[model samples]
Target: MEAVDLTAEQRAIIEADASDLAVSAGAGSGKTRVLVERYVQLLRECSIPQIAAITFTEAAAAEMRDRVRREVMSDPALEQHRALLDEAAIGTVHSLGLRLLREHPVEAGLDPAAAVLADDEAELLRRAACIEAIDAAAEVGGERTRALLGLGVYHAGLQLPRMVAQRDAVGAAFAAMGAYSADWPSYVRATLEAHYEPRQTAIRGQAEEIAWQIRRDAGNVTERLAEVAGAVLQPLTAAREAREWGDFAALLAEARSQTNLQSGGNAPAAVNVKGAMKELRELDDDAGKLPAWNEHDEPALEVLAGLRALFEDSVRRYEAAKQAQNALDYLDLELGAVDLLRDHPAVAAAVRGRFLHLMVDESQDINPVQAELIELIAGGNGDGARPALFLVGDARQSIYRFRGADVHRFPAQQALV
Candidate 1:
């Protein structure tokens, strides 16, 4: 392509030779133009089939492909490469997976002729699976069944499908690593442990330290101030000795229940007393982070676990039903691609060979599954030389969580690159 009147920043982006590049550009800032120009430059050195350009949507992909074709046509020197633009790998991640599976049907363990299920067909199958799951739960007739029944009654039997609709987001949330990864049970357990155990320990330690300081200063303060300080220590001592987790909240409440301690009038001595009282009250307020458990919380926790089991069973039934129809949904498409790349080394190598460079657009909206597929395709396993990875997205623009987008994954992927 001929050189055009471009800003220095746009020229730099097009000319940069970084192995892994991440562009953070806002809308109408020529992000697409930079990507198209960069792609055209790469095409001069690499075959069109050796590069992969992935976008979040088919329309964006088409626009990029069109721009690349236009650039090729604009250059008389690039006349021979015009026909190759039609064969370039430019599409959404789902389309990329579909192409991969189509190329290696046997390795992907699918019937060569198997088709993706239409939205209406998938919804019908999901409904059938939900009904079957409900009937099976009724036969069992236990806590799990009761939870499912309650949810179904509340949502008029749409609860299962609703949860299924959010399967991708839930799965992405669960798959996050480190402190971010926690299921319902794990979250509850962690919260309780933080509040009742480690948090209690820290609170007691801080209270004892403050109590000692109060005792040391009591003799220098007015009699009223000393009296208030002793009163403050009582609740802290009680909290330190309390064995029941339930009593901690009560102690905090008692500590905060003291009034008028901070309302002393404007005498010098009274002002000093009020200042001390204010500090003690602030400590009590800080201790209130430990939430009080309601009488129904224990029972509700039990019901939540049962409901989680029911949801898992429903998901299994839904997958089975889809498999029986030799069909794949959108989630299945992404997951199947990951599995194909991970399990079949020959196929993975073939894919790696086919695409030497990978450019992803709107990458901030990528979920865990799509991220995994990208990593695998880019040889991110540390087993070999990685491909040239180019990511362009504005994390602030990633708002597709209901469709399984995790904005946080962008930073993690950037770190990987």
Candidate 2:
């Protein structure tokens, strides 16, 4: 093949050894060109049948295939190998996975003629599964379940169908990208620890000062001021001894509920108690500013857990329904391919042998499942001779997160490579 114009970095990438490699470049920086050139170089050493190049989109795959074919045709000596290009694995990851599953149906545990459900068809199946899951949940009634049912009803009335319709995308994010798995309690506690812990000390100090002032002025203080001081002491002591998070939250709530302690009221002692009560109220307000995890957050967490469970249950039901119909979705293609490679060593070896060089485009846009697919296909399982794995992507361009693309995987995958 003729030497094409390439930057120093591009030349380095093309000349890299058979070890795994990751290439990062900005948009319009010839990433795809570098990939094609590298593929052509590999073709010189390996047969076209031994090469596999995966891209993010069908258009990119087609473009890459065309570019490679053009580069091959441009070389007079390489004309004989042009026909083998059509048989090479060059397509989107999903297409490659579907091909893998088709090639090893029994090993993948999928029917040989299983049909892939289109988006609209998958939506129907998902809706059916969600309805079934909701019915099942409703059959078993409890306080939590009732709360879940109410949420389901609210969702149904508001936007449940729309949300369910978009479940494939959202589910993909959760399953592949690890979204919504945050440690909320830890986060809330951390925030409170940072913002409220110091304030707790200040509030306790203020309570002690107020108590001292009341005792010092006891001779001049009215009955009303003494009673108000006792009211303040109750929660002050409770706050001092507050150990559990729930107790602290309750103390804050009780402090906030002292609405009767007005700034100035009809009673004569109200004037004397106003300043202390105002300070206490200010402290209560500060406590309220902290996360309300102990009182109001549990229900939210429970509901969120329930919704996640429902979504998972729906997914399982949806998968069962698809399997029963001998059909699959886009996700199933990658998962089935991965499972096949994982569970059957012989089959994995055969697949690995077929593609001696694996090249992936838009590597930053790949989710964990797709990354695993690439790793398995490239023999990253510490098994036999690992194939040369080449990846090209710009992490800054990883904008397909809604489609399960996780930019964080870029560094991790780079380290793995």
Q: Give a tens-digit lDDT track for model 2, residues 16-125.
A: 87778988888999888889889988877878888889998878998998998898888876777888878879998888889988888777777877898876898788
The number of the candidate with the highest TM-score is 1
TM value for model 2: 0.66
Q: Per-residue alpha-carbon lDDT of model 1 for 1-417, expressed as tens digits?
A: 445677888888888884778888877887888889989888777778888989987689999988989888898867878888788899988889988988888888878777787657877877777777777877888867767655654452576666665676554444441232134545665667764787767766666665566656656666676677667668867877776656865775676565346443565655554555566567667667666556766566565555655666778998888777777887778888999999998788778767768999888989888999998988456555556888888888886776768998888778756
Which 10-residue span in candidate 2 carries the lowest summed lDDT? 156-165
Over 4 Å off, model 2? 1-4, 131-294
Using all chains and alpha carbons, the TM-scores for the candidates as numbered come to: 0.72, 0.66
| Candidate 1 lDDT | 0.74
Give the Å shift of residue 103 in candidate 2.
1.9
Candidate 1: residue 97 Cα off by (Å): 1.3
